[model samples]
Target: MRVFYAVVLLAAVLVLNFSLMHLAPGDVADTISQSMGGADQEILDKIRADYGLDKPFLVQLGHYIGRVLQFDLGHSFFFNQPVTQLILQRLPATLLLVISAQILALVLGVVLGVYSARKPNSIANYFVTFFSLFGYSAPVFWTGILLLIAFSLKIPWFPVAGMRDVTISGGFWIQFWDVARHLVLPMITLSSIFIALYSRLSRATMMETLGADYIRTAKAKGLSNRQVIYKHALKNSLSPVITQAGIQFSAMMSGAVLVEAVFSWPGLGTLAFQSIIARDTPTILGILFFSALVVIVGNLLTDLALRLVDPRVGGRK
Candidate 1:
């Protein structure tokens, strides 16, 4: 049943994405002509026909859906490359940003949450609460720009942009840290909101867990305060946090566009930005297709993960 829904949803997404691409202003042929210093009408018409832009919208969409089922994403008009190849090339950089941010956010948020929950009245608790509110509420682009100025410009700790230094030559590990160093700022910007959200959620859920009847029973059995938290409360509190993490993963992917543009990071988001400016319909639709598919699949996996973490969700299974 779930598989059926997933297939139907992806089909609907394909249709809508194709229709909306046509609705966007300026076709690729026009951009091409303008780049050619206002090329003659005959050239423009030939370009359109060559790219199947002259076809009826329904016919084009039908052909597109067929190609998608065959796992072909078409070519990029602007980049002159296969869509799959381009996406594959940029995918690793984006994955590094996304994965790093998730891990950092999860670790920092959970740690801060646990400490705050254990020391409700301490200065550290107040500071964490204040930081979370600020982190979550601020605009991501704004936060990214501020960090770029303070850390990249003034402090000069990390490079301003790009996945790695083209000049850096060494063995694999040396190249690896170069990219990691460049990633630090973007990762922090990408994860700040999630970290803030997770911290507050963990605190709230932990408080409830600590007050539960089972917690009291454990304490009555002579379990220490530390054991009550580590053995009993922490695991249950993490169920909601894990679910939230999955949901945030989708949002973070979409939001990476702004960060990528700001820092000139070479990722899918950067590709999307450049494609839009060039009026590259195929590339734009490709990105939309990927984003929609990822969100749906991510949500499904989140459900499965939540079920594993909390057996109440799985029930008989």
Candidate 2:
């Protein structure tokens, strides 16, 4: 049933995206003409005919849907490549940054939240409170710029842009470390806000769970503090955090655009940015479609994870 719903939803998304892009002002021919300084009506008309822009909206949409059904996302107007191929080439970098940031946020958020809940009025709790407030309040781009200045310019701890060092030549581990180093600043920049969010949520849930009847019973049964907290309370508190993580995955993808542009990371975000500037509707739509698919898959995995964490979730469903 879930899979069926996902298919239906994806189709709806495809139609809506296609309609919106069609309605938007200008087309690939306009962008191409502008890039060429100017063009006569004949050249513009030829360009439109070549790209099938002359087709009626419904006809174009039908053709697009047919191509998509065959796993063909169409060609890029600017890159002169298959949309799917371009996306595939850039996907790993985007996935690496987004997933790494998510993991970093979840781990640090859960740990800080648990500790803060355990020591509510302590200095560490206060510190966590301050960090969360700032992280949550700051704009993602602004935070990214700050990190760039402090780490890249002032102290020179990390590279200013790009994913890997072209100058460095070494074995696999050495190359891997170079990439990892480049990843650190962007990952931190992207994860900062999410870490703030998760930490606060975990703290609230953990605090509530600690006061629950089960927790009291566990303590009464002579369970150690670690056993009670880790084994009893923490498990129950994770569902909401996981739910938030799943919901925010799409937002992270969008946010990655700003982060990617700031750091010049060669990801879909950068590709999407370039496509938009070029009015490359096919490439833009392809990115949006792929992003939607990723978000849907992330939500499904979140459901699966929840079912594992608490089988009662599946039972209730």
Candidate 3:
């Protein structure tokens, strides 16, 4: 059933993305002409026909859908390469950034949340609240810029941008360290928002669970504070946090666009940015399509995780 819904949603998204691209102002031929230093009507017509832009709207959409079903993203006009290949080349970078950022966010957020929830009105709770607000309110691009300047400029702690410096000659470990150095800023920038969200949610839910009847009963039954908090309360408190994790996962995937552009990360988001500049329809649509799929899968995984954590979830119709 989830698969069916995802398919329907993807179909609608593809249609909308394609239609909006065609409907957007400015002729492809005109843009092509400008880029190529002015081509005649014959050349322009051939270009349009070759790219199937000369076809009727419905016909073009039909062809596109057919190609999509076959796992074909078609060729990128600007890049002069297969869209799938371009996406595959960039997918790993984005995945590394997203996965690393989410892991950092999850671990740090859960830790801070648990600690703060136990502390109540202490300094630690206030610090967590302040950090959450700062992360939530700060713009992605701005945060990225600050990190870039602080670490890459004044302090000289990391590289300013790109995934890796292939220019350096070294073995695997040397190259790995170089890439990890470059990844630090963007990952921090991307993960900050997710950390803010998860930490706040965890703190709130944990606080509620700490006050619950079961938690009180556990304390009454001679369970230590650590056991009561971790073994009992925290487990029950995680359902909402788990749900938010799915949502934030999707959020970070989408938010990567600004973060990628800021740091020149050479990921899916950077590819989409370039494609948009050159009006590369195929590449743009392909990125968007794959991104939507990722978000959907993240949500599905979240739902499954929730069921596992608390069997009562989805146990009934």
Candidate 4:
């Protein structure tokens, strides 16, 4: 039943995306023509016809939907490469950034949250709360620039832009190190907001769980502090954290456009931004669908994880 709903939602998203793109004032051919010094009407019409833009909306949408089902996203107007190829080339870098940011956020946020919950109303809790607010409120691009200036320019600890140094060449380890070096600034920028949100959410969830009857019963049973927190409170606290993290993951994947453009990370967000400026419909649609898939998959995985963590949830539905 869940799988069925997922399919229906994805289909609706695809249709909405196709209709909106088609309804836009100008087609890809018009965009291409204007960029190329204003081609004659005949030439523009030919380009449109070649790209199937001349077809009626339903027919074009039908062809597009059929092709997508077959794993074909069609050609790119600007890059002169398959849309799939362009996406694949950029996907790894984006994934690396997103994954790194997520890991940092989860680990640090969970720890801080747990600590804050344990030490509620103490100075440490207050400090964590204060810092979280700053992290959450700061703008991503501004944060990136500040990090660039302080770390990259002032401290000279990291490079300002690009994924690698021009001097480095060959070997997997060397390439990995280079990518890591460039990733630091962007990852930190991307992670700050998520870390703040996660910390708050975790702290809240943990505090509530700590006050639960099971936790008090465990305490009465003379369980060690660590066991009470870890085995009793923490496990129950995870459902909400997992739910928030799943939703945040999807948002980060789609919402990193500004950070990607600011940092020039060559991720899907950057690609989508460029495609929009160029009015590259295939690339834009590709990104939208890819992002939707990520969100859906992330949510599904979260649900599964939640069920495993607490079988009661699985039995409920």
Candidate 5:
């Protein structure tokens, strides 16, 4: 089954990731020892033994994989907290930002794409195509910086960095609004590329759908333009868009690392970045496996959406 294949592939990727992390030049014990101001050899060896770093590579890996299967990601050397606890705390903020951006991209992308398809050779279509390329090609961190300068510093409309104002503390609603206020810049930064991509994809899909015989027949039978486009063409065109959206969502979740770091947003990406720097293998592996799970689940959801949109796809080999 497709699900079984996906799970097997994900498991392989996780194993490879674990091996590569171990094979990296420095051991976690060495990193910890160095950070602790040149501890004595005996003490360093004790610390290594305490954390199982003194074990053979295969033994360490086996224990790690076993613990992971048991949902025990172990404690973070840097944070002194369980990796799952840390990730769960930060995941919502990242999800809020990315999911909102995705919605914006889908709505704007579909609308602009449909309009461009309706007038393929028109100036509006040309302009949309040109701008989409520019948006897609832009660097996310650079874009975040520009938005920070333009809106946060220059215009003074939003916070320059961090997830929320440190001073605001009252109730859930107050906290939520504060977080939302700071989220605008990073959301826009993340959404820009997706918007461009969705627009281009939607335009292509719509264009193809418009050229289909069914669309022409519907138009010839005297259906209104809106009805023909919406009721018929849009429905069929959505399959591809749904697929792209799923993939894009997965990419955004992983790729938000740079954007989160730039904006100082507390999210899995930032957490993962810090973990990598600190050589916190538990946190790093936790994030890697979590991200893979998200991508797989997203793809599954996309398949379900496709089936709902067009049942023929569900029935096909």
Candidate 6:
């Protein structure tokens, strides 16, 4: 049933994205004409006909849906390449950035939340609260710029832009380290806000979970503080955090656009930005479809994780 719903939802998303994009002002033809120093009506018409943009809206949409069904995302007017190929080239970079940020946020957030919850009146707890408020309030792009200025300019600890050192020539590990260095600022910037959210949420959930009857019973049974909190309370508190993570995947993807733009990372976000500027409908639409697919798949995986964490949620017992 979940798979069935996902398919239906994907189809709806495809149709909606196609409709909205095509309905927007200007298109690839206009962009091309402008780039070519403003062509005559005959030239513009020829360009439209060549790209099949001369077809009626319904006919164009039909062809688009048919091609998509076959995994043909069409060609980019500006890039002069297949949309699928272009997206595939950049998908890895975006996935790396977004997933890395998410993992960082989740790990740090959960740890900080748990620690703070364990000692609500401690200095560490106060620091966590302050940090959460500041991180949550600061914008992602602003964070990236500040990191760039501090680490890349003033401190000179990392490179300012791009995914890897194009100038460097070395072995796999050296190259890996280079890429990892470039990834640091962007990942940190993207994860900062989410960390704030997850920390606060986890703290609240942990506090409540610690007060549960089972938690008290576990302590009464001679369990140590660490055992009671880490083993008994932590798992129950993670449900909401996991659920929120699943729901926030799409927002993280959106945030990646700004972060990628700031750092000049060669990812789907950068590709989407360029495509939008050039009115590359095929490329933009393809990115939207791919993004939607990723979010849906992420949500499905979240469901699976929840089932593993709590079998009762799936009625497995």
C-alpha RMSD for every candidate: 1.6, 1.1, 1.6, 1.7, 1.9, 0.9
User: What digit string (tens of lDDT, one per residue) describes model 1 on residues 1-317?
Assistant: 77689889989998998998888777999999998889888999999999999999889999999998987889999999978788878877877887788889988998899889989999999999999999989988999999999999999999998888999989999998999899999999989998999999998898888899999999999999889998899988999899899889888898788888878889989999999999988888888888777778877888888887787886565
lDDT of 2 by residue, 1-317 (tens): 88899999999999999999999999999999999999999999999999999999999999999999999999998999999999999999999999999999999999999999999999999999999999999999899999999999999999999999999989999999999999999999999999999999999999999999999999999999999999999999999999999999998999899999999999999999999999999999999999999999999999999998887887574
User: Which regions of candidate 3 are displaced past 4 Å?
Assistant: 169-171
Clashes of each: 0, 0, 0, 0, 0, 0
Error of 3 at 50 (Å): 1.6
Task: Encode model 4's per-residue lDDT on 1-317: one tens digit a residue.
Answer: 88889988888888899999988887788888888889999999899888888889999899988998888888888778888888889888887888899889988898999999999989999999998999999988999999999998999999888888889998999898898899989998999999899999999999999989999999999999999998999889888888888889887886477779888888898899989988999988888888787778778988998898887887675
Model 6 spans > 4 angstroms off = none
Q: Which is superior by TM-score, 1 or 5?
A: 1
Candidate 1 clashes between residue pairs 3 or more apart in a chain or in different chains? none
Candidate 2 whole-model C-alpha lDDT, 0 to 1: 0.96
**lDDT for model 5, on a 0 to 1 scale?**
0.87
lDDT of 3 by residue, 21-72 (tens): 8899765667788988999989989988878889899999999999999999
Clashes of 3: 0
lDDT of 6 by residue, 125-153 (tens): 99999999999999999999999999999
Worst 10 residues of 2 by lDDT: 308-317
Q: Write the per-residue lDDT of candidate 5 for residues 52-164, one digit (tens) a residue.
A: 88899899888887888888878888899998898889888777877888888888889989999999999999999997998899999999999999998889999988888
Native-structure RMSD, model 3: 1.6
Tell how far residue 249 is off in model 5, in angstroms: 2.8
TM-score of each: 0.95, 0.98, 0.95, 0.94, 0.93, 0.98
TM-score of 5: 0.93
Error of 6 at 158 (Å): 1.3
